[model samples]
Target: MKDSLELRTVTVTRYITPLREGGSLPALAEADDDFKYVLKFRGAGHGVKALIAELLGGLIARELGLKVPELVFAELDEAFGRTEADEEIQDLLQFSKGLNLALHFLSGALTFDPAAETVDDTLASKIVWLDAFITNVDRTFRNTNMLIWHKELWLIDHGAAFYFHHSFSNWEKSAETPFSFIKDHVLLPRASKLYEVDQEFKKILNRDKFVAIVDQIPTEWLEWEGSDFSANEIREVYLNFLLRRLESSTIFINEANKWRDASI
Candidate 1:
């Protein structure tokens, strides 16, 4: 078999162990000395939306040169048994199995203390920029829909990022009119723990490097009348939008630039 296929097969088997449960993709497998992974089955009803978002959002984030887990399409079979489900079962089988970053399921995979003072002001500012570009409103304290791995932020569960794609007017409100998040939250409280040691992330936030990163975004991920937007056009739209935000910011470009330098 081809290497990618083989890897996919291995990943499926790794997540087979029956362990814990809960969450959209429940925890079935845990940390083990051998063949460890997060057991995920496709028959649950709640995951269909999240799965689609994960796939598309992951692609976009990767194209923007952001850190995320390796995503692969997989099938659940003898190697990976089915899980019991409630009324949500039929919805789950609507799609096939997908293998994601299994290491995240490990109890010790990440040392996360959401309340801990890990995130810094500079890093928070950049994340806000990313969220704004994607229009991701779900990254609030309620969900804190992110995870850290090896001290690096690995974005996950983007089922909420592209809601506007489903309906362009869903967010008809312009970036102007006082947004709720801005009124309350203090982002960029600390540098992201991930940036503290990641050179790749540093390279990514550079003005020239950042624009190049935007260029890599897959056209398929953008939500348009058709998947017809050119990569350059998409990059331009994102850049212009962010530029407007910087122009509107209380700290102006200075804060954004601070992240570029402090991130490393």
Candidate 2:
């Protein structure tokens, strides 16, 4: 794995089309690298916080041996989208004229269907553990946010994770709380090894790894218009939250196990 701080930067050259599947309006664009990417704009509804969650969540999941598309810091030039006819998209491009996030496009990949494909206990457990740890509210049956590329399950669209940052209150308490929403997880029924994987995952992630991931957040993202906290302070909060959350993994592990047992 590459260092957490070493994401490849690509300049978007063309906006091919708008992917209207989600509220964020991520696009299919070609970058200067001559590859297509699903670009997540910083100016979307959730703003840069969503980009932060996407970056952190994808990196953490990759560190855990999960399949995630390559993430890149996609640069949007100020003059790139001036020709867009859509008013909304034009405004979005205008506001997102900086470093955004994008995932390598998996050509011909199909959306994961729980009824069509089977997941083993270990993989499912790890995924459930990850979602609980990040407090990701997506990944329900209604919208799996998972894809099957080359016949392997790949996770995607983690903008919904780390919701505590949206409110920015009582983060310590939030870190320790049991994420009850794990019950709605699409893979929970197969995640019978939550406790087993919890121990394994904890060993793979450490304070240093967490710090490296948190430090990768661009300083501009932390400088929200009206926020009182400095960029460094916000980064520290993210690091502390992950550390505390890791120490308290059993809280969410037990919660996931409880739901898995009841569901089965």
Candidate 3:
């Protein structure tokens, strides 16, 4: 496994197409490394906060033994999308002429269909626990945000996680709060081993690992408009939030158990 602080940097060579599935207009672009990636623009509607959440959520999931696509820092030159026909996309590219987030594109992958597919109790419990841990509200039955690639589950599109950063008031309180949205999770019905996996998963992550992950966030992303905290201060906030959340894991684990039990 690569070091938690290490992420490769790639330059965008071509903008193939736009993924219009969600509010953020992430694109399927080719990089200088000759690999295609789903590029998440920092200039999207959700802005840099979404990118920060994406980095934190994806990396944290990988640390806990889940399969997430390789994340890279994709660079866009100032002249890179100037000729685009779409005014909106052109504006987005112009505004995002710096380091952005992208995930290794999975070719020929299919969206996870809960009705036609099955997930074991262990995997389901782990996934549920992860979503709850990050406070991700987008992994409902309506939009699983998961893919089936090479006959294995792959997680994706975690820009919606860590929403507390959007408005950092009382963030410490938010960290300890149990996620009630676990009830709507697509795999909630199959997550019978929530308590069992909770014990094992807790051992896989710690404050040191979290500090390394949070340190991976670029300093530019932390300098959001209208923020009172400095870049270094914001980094500390992220570290503190993760540590507090981990210490209070049982609060969410119990909440997930409560919902899972009532659903059956």
Candidate 4:
């Protein structure tokens, strides 16, 4: 069941502090919805593709029964940049004068210190499966892009996932691409039910489900110049890669299982 997750559009009311922790320089902004959001700018470091990944990854996690912050579309006006002091930041704000992606600000969310905190095998396995499915490279023991909010693990910062999009030319051939990085996944050792998670996801994920996820992305985000693919063609390409990856002998799942077994 596609939760029918649609990205809500909110306008930026006030520019809060800049979250320098992220490489993209996302900001904590007050949205018109009466909530603060961690805005990922379309015109940021990696362009709109990163924002697209964040939306897709987060929504997928939600569908997979994983804890993820609410994803929304944020509107930014040119006038908001006038109050900024730094030239670089001002330029970034100015460039991102249109709709951007935002994740609901999790207040008082404690940092997930894997060393101190613990996760059950099932929960850990699901997250590991999702990361592997999405080919996310950001989640590692060194940099866990997860937080403990309301006593539950919440995933974040998916901009680094879906690296194959950067090389769309080979995306089709890369369907069976193994995410060797899963061996270093922060929760690999704890994912005792890795195979179970893989099977469950395979049962739920289908072409319609995957296409629904891609359809949620704004058309403008899909549109790009200098690419052989038009907006509609790019959507089909994304759907095709996901569909093909789910075919017989998924390389990522096998690799993850190997890592889990070796850890045991």
Q: Best candidate per lDDT, number?
A: 2
TM-scores, one per candidate: 0.50, 0.98, 0.98, 0.95
Give residue 14's lDDT in candidate 4 (0 to 100): 89
Tens-digit lDDT track of model 1 for 44-146? 4233334444444555566555665555444444423344443243244233344332323534445345686367554665565555444555665556656
With candidate 4 superimposed using the best TM-score fit, by how many Å does residue 91's alpha carbon deviate from the native? 0.9
Where's the lowest-lDDT run of ten residues in candidate 3?
A: 194-203
Q: How many residue pairs of model 2 clash at the backbone?
A: 0
Instruction: Summarize candidate 3's per-residue lDDT along 1-264 as a digit string, tens digits.
Output: 978558999999999999997788999999999999999999998889999999999999999989999999999999999999999999999999999999999999999999999999999999999999999999988999999999999999889899898888888999998989888999999998987888998788888898899999999999978888999999999899999998899999899989888988
Q: Which regions of candidate 1 are displaced past 4 Å?
A: 1-11, 14-49, 63-65, 77-107, 168-264
Tens-digit per-residue lDDT, 142-218, candidate 2: 99999999989999999999999998989999999899999999999999888889889988999989988888898
Clashing pairs in 2: none
Using lDDT as the yardstick, the better of models 1 and 2 is 2
Clashes of each: 13, 0, 0, 0
Quality of model 3 by C-alpha lDDT: 0.93
Candidate lDDT scores, in order, read: 0.45, 0.94, 0.93, 0.86
Residue pairs in collision within model 3: none
Clashing pairs in 4: none
lDDT of 2 at 157: 96
- Model 1 residue 128 CA deviation (Å) reads 1.6
lDDT, candidate 4, 54-172, per-residue tens: 98899889888888899999988878788789988898999898889999999999878999999999999899888887889999999999999888899999998888888678886
